[model samples]
Target: MASPQQYLNNPNVRKLLDVIASAEGVRHGYNTIFGNERFSNLSAHPNVRKSFRQTDGKTNFTTAAGRYQFLKGTWDGLSRQYNLKDFSPQSQDIGAIGLIMQKGALGDVLKGNYQAAIQKLGGTWASLPSSPYAQPKRSQAEINKLLGGSAQQGGYQPQYLSAKDEVRLFGKSQPQTIRQKYLSAEDEAKLFPQQQPPATRYLSAEDEVRLFQQSNQNTQQSSYLTPEQEAKLFPGG
Candidate 1:
């Protein structure tokens, strides 16, 4: 008979274990981060359930068992939300590993093993667990094929944007622009009705120069204007 550790080493079992662990970790993390005054305030509110439903599509779970169920449900929901399929088992496993890693790292950090925690929870942390599902190689073509070719036809090219790229895009793209890009025409029309267009106030070259001068004067008068704001007022041509 295999030892407990040996049993954990089994690919399939490990995957399942990891998924559970990760789900638990996420719950713990959320509770920890938002558990105190904020959570209490929200929980005590009469409209808390409705608010939670709006944000998470479900109210906060009351009991421990209910919370556990909610966590599992959330994991599944996220998978669907991201259109992350075919690797359900793997995704679950990774999530579990992440939780375990997070817990271990936290414990280590609390114990002042900051470096160790950082090392273990670093960028390659997900690959640390010995599971067959860890880091499953996927190709865009394969994903497109899996998505029934509609993904390709719809210009849904899958590219892993980095955190910085995501931030940059978020800063650059307005809500309207993003919605227009991602939402179907029918959906957009339903969600956003064409209101009377905002009155267009065209600025001539003189108006632009006058506005710049006023902005510059304001910046010079007020010490509150940041360097970036000043730079924006007089941008490089």
Candidate 2:
């Protein structure tokens, strides 16, 4: 079945995540907090409240932490919605995928439609192209490079699910009861969060289309809160 962690194994998805990390300046530090705020726990969201100056030249108190630079409100909403268990690297990746799904970018992302995906995602990540925030953001060319480049031969390949996998997920005959689209703690546990996940072969675009349709049928469409909403919810976020 199409699960959160499965998306992380996708070449395009992984590259997109790398783009986010690079843009957020967390390429080497998934544990790093926003604006040099400090923390130690991986068991849960490190709700580290501190004021930090952004490039905008004004200090905003924030809980923006981890590889994706999630603010507390954003993280909370994602965690609860996706059943993300902690602030661990695995959980963070899953949470990021959750954000992608939330922003309606997963279909475009699966198809390596970078511009469209980035457009949908920009609001949630200010450092991405098309962001509403006035912060410094990456150019399309820069994002292309991070995604292994569009013209680079044999650099990245699209992922597709096998026929058997497709049948199991969508059913061969009568439609099986639609299952939960998000992962459970038990499901997440099967992933072995401590270890680096193996390279993932992914679902076909057709399968992805169906999976996306199935997911929309099952999950609530909760948009990421706006910058103003975040600031109000988290005070300095």
Candidate 3:
């Protein structure tokens, strides 16, 4: 694994990972990029810096704090190996870089292999919603824009069950029952303030995708919210 200094030595890799971090929602000092305010509000405080052992013989703590959303599980394996301190923003940033380096995406990232880098990093970042890995993938265009690079065309395969595949499986792609879906609590709170946000918890991309598939039969279905709904949800820009 590359040392934090070595990782830092390559500014482009750092920048790319920073873009991923931003995509992962690490915009604040004490919260994930999403609005998870109040660090001390959980069994394991969201802003917890040190790793702690829970009563169930498992460790519980904020591994996802800092600017990079470093999970405690990942940090547990990496902390001593890298001589990391606590879960400060700097520590989180370094840990994120370390994760990318460990995933073997560092070199590809430095070489401007956006899609390759995204593919490599996808193992760790679930937010890359469009990855073939079936995890939640963010927009490649948006990620590329953040990296100051042009979008890498193709190579991404959506993991959801497509309409054709659904038809093959169920004879008819559409589910017999289509219920009206409300905005996800996480999304509703962030996009629409009228509704109260639920307690914050880490929802993996797989969980999100599975829920998405359960909701709509069309694997390639578009936005959950229509333009009118979106306009109401996000009145501003």
lDDT per residue as tens, model 2, 3-101? 687787898888778888898876335678876555677888777887756677986777788989989998888888778888888889998888888
Q: In candidate 2, where is summed lDDT lowest over 10 consecutive residues? A: 198-207
Which of 1 and 3 is the better model by TM-score? 3
Residues 24-46 of candidate 3 have per-residue lDDT tens digits of 76555434523343363222325
Best by TM-score: 2
Against the hidden reference, what TM-scores do the models get? Answer: 0.17, 0.58, 0.49
lDDT of 1 by residue, 156-195 (tens): 6644445454454446554543232354455445545564
Sort the predicted structures by lDDT, highest score first: 2, 3, 1
Between candidates 1 and 3, which one is better according to lDDT?
3
- Higher-TM-score candidate among 2 and 3? 2
In candidate 3, list every pair of residues with a backbone clash: 25-33, 26-33, 63-70, 63-72, 128-137, 128-138, 129-136, 129-137, 129-138, 130-137
lDDT of 3: 0.60
Off by over 4 Å in 3: 29-35, 38-63, 130-136, 151-237
- Report each candidate's C-alpha RMSD, comma-separated, in the order given: 24.8, 29.0, 25.9
